[model samples]
Target: MDWGQIFNSTAGWLFSPTTIAYALAATGLAVHFGYAGLLNFGMAGFMAIGAYGYAISILTFGLPWWAAMFVSILGAVVFALILGIPTLRLRADYLAIVTIAAAEIVRLLFTTQVFDEYTNSADGLSGYHQGFRDANPFPEGTYGFGPWTYNQNELWVRVFGVILLAIAVLAVWLLMRSPWGRVLKGIREDEDAVRALGKNVFSFKMQALIIGGIMGALGGVVFALPSAVVPATYTTSLTFFIWTILLLGGAATVFGPALGALIFWVIMAFLDNVLPAMAAVGWLPMTPIQAGTLRFILVGVALMLLVAFRPQGILGNKRELTFVK
Candidate 1:
């Protein structure tokens, strides 16, 4: 039960690439539900397409990183269009139903044996990061301060992830302040009113869907940067986790989701470390397996308290924005 060890582990998440990736995905979710009021519950699917599309493009098609990234983006755009075309004009719940089903469908397809040659049949894809690695700016060495240090590759991913998150936050912030963003928020508040003002509500929803899906796809690429792309990684639980991150931060505001992502991971890290230590020290009457499960149970209780006390979240203001309906 070393306090220093737990602190180091918890602090590492402050600049974690995975956390940054989740932040980016949550930011996309913010754009979808916060600003656009679209019930897109399948962000995991978009992320899956992005990860698999990029990986397959590199491993199967022999494409470079840039080309592979483009392929992933294309895949996301096509997914958004397909998901939105038949449902954008209908009630928002339909989009949610379609997105959740579509996400599961994508996951199952990857898990099936039919596309084992391409998708590897749930074993996932890897060994395609060389092109991006060859472009690393940092020399081969450990970097950063104590308790926050990382190898050159890890540092590269962090630098790249932060730059991407900054660009996304800037883009979302700027977009939310523009005329188009205004309409999206207006639609969120009252779509029929925006429709009465002669704006094509369906068109705006489609645009938001595509933009958010592309962001999720890009986030997916970042998420799968250091690891293999597994179907299990793109589960409905992941989407729910992103939603929790979005709500933990300010949903309607830019950067909130990323901040929320950071906080969420930090809390989880703390629980992961502290709970095990407590169990080891006999402070908690629990086995190793029980300790692992307890962390999430504690997180659930904390979330319930947060929702009950401050549903607006850390950076969120105006409780009305928390209501999706």
Candidate 2:
């Protein structure tokens, strides 16, 4: 129960690759549900495609890092089109059902023995970050100050992740401010009205789906930068977690998802550290394992309360929220 260790561990997540990954994924979710009113519950599936795509390309084809990244984004686009073709015209609930099922299917496929040679099934893929690391500008030494130091490799990953996040945020902001962005908002508000005004509602929806899915896929690749590609990491819970971040930050706003991700991870890190320390010190009556579960329970209750009281979220405009009838 060392206070210094706990603080450092919790603070580490503030700039960690995982935080950047969640920020990117949440941003994509914001585009899907916030601006376009698309119920894409398979964000994790898109991420898996990106992760596996990048990993397979690196391990098998020995593609360059930039090339592998482009392929991963391309993979996301193709997956989005495949998922959106028949489902976008269906009801929102139908899209949700299809997406959730599709994500599970993708995860299981990656875990199966058939593609184990390429995917490594449960063992996943590793040692794919060599090319990425070789391009680092930082010298081989620890960087950062105080409790926030990182080795050259970790710092390189963080820098790459931040650059991608910045580009994504800028891209999203620009897109959401243009005429195309206006059409997307209009579709979210009232698709029939947009259609009557000569807008191709279906086409716009598909484009939005593809764009957001690609973002999620890119996020997946970033998420796996510091770690191996594990199929178990892309589960239904991952999508739900991203949704929570989107809702917490205020969907539809350009920076809301990123802010939400930062906050969510910070809170989780704090709880992960504080709860265990409290239990260990007898400040809580529960064992350490029970404390771990309790933290999630607290987070669940907090989410429920947030939805019940402020469904529009922290940075969301209530006027922008419209459920299609």
Candidate 3:
């Protein structure tokens, strides 16, 4: 059991690109399920669109990185409109069912051979990194120390992810403090009452869905920044992970989702390292393969416990989140 190696790996995830991406996505989830009381289960679909949109724009249209990102945002907006127009008025549970199914449909479409010319047909897309790499301001050198060390390009991706996350957090903070944010909260508490007050509940819900979807899109961009766009990466499990992060931090709080992402990944990283190490050292009664898979079981159990006992999450106010009717 190499404690040093485990610690180094765990520390690396402290500010990894993956953590930043999850933070951004979880913040969007907070906007949906936290402040707006929307049960959105299709965030994975938005992320898939963002990633593939950016990739296709670059590979097919020869668009610049920034422009490709913009196209991704537009794709998310269009997806939001398509998803929200007919579904926002449905009950929350129904919306969840529709969203989860819709996300699967999006994934399957990407996997299908119909768009193999662009999508690569489940082989996933790559070679889209050059445009983003060209924009890197970090010179060609190693940066940071210990587990945080990375080449210039890696550092650039982390910095870019952090900047996007910061902007998202700031934006959500400001919005949640405004009158519009208040209305979202009102609708979350009771949409019928807000509608009776002459507010367009559907419009507000649609707006929230769009905003949250944009956040999910940005998360996808950040995720694609450091790696290829793989269809398998944008499954329902990804949405569940984002939800876990949001719920772990605090649904309605501005910094909760980011905090949750950091903690969640750190824990996962720790388990990923320690579990296998324990099994290898004969400390655990399992093979390394089994130990590696046990982390997911542990995470599931932890989530169940959190929902049962601390549904408000680490930073959440119990009154701000209601898991039960």
Best by lDDT: 3
Candidate 1 contains a number of clashing pairs equal to 0
What TM-score would every model get versus the actual structure? 0.97, 0.97, 0.98
Judged by whole-model lDDT over C-alpha atoms, candidate 1 comes out at 0.89
Q: Which scores higher on TM-score, 2 or 3?
A: 3
Give the best candidate by TM-score. Answer: 3
Give stretches of model 1 more than 4 Å off. Answer: 319-325
Which residue pairs in model 2 clash with each other? none
Report the error of model 2 at residue 77, Å.
0.8
Candidate 1 residue-wise lDDT, 1-325, digit = tens? 7899889989999998789889989999999998898888999999999999999999999999889999999999999999889888777777788889999998999899999999998788899989988889999998989889989889888899888889889999999999999999999998889999999999999999999898899899999898789898999989988988988897887878988999999998998888878888798999756897798888778778877777777888764473723
The residue ranges of model 3 lying beyond 4 angstroms of the native Cα positions read none
Lowest-scoring 10 consecutive residues by lDDT in candidate 3? 316-325
Once superposed on the true structure, which residue ranges of model 2 sit more than 4 Å away at CA? Answer: 323-325
lDDT of 2 by residue, 128-206 (tens): 9999998989999999987679999999998888898888889889999999999999998889999999999999999
**CA-only RMSD, every prediction:** 1.4, 1.4, 0.9
Better structure of 1 and 2 per TM-score: 2
How many angstroms is residue 72 displaced in model 1 relative to the true structure, after the best TM-score fit?
0.9
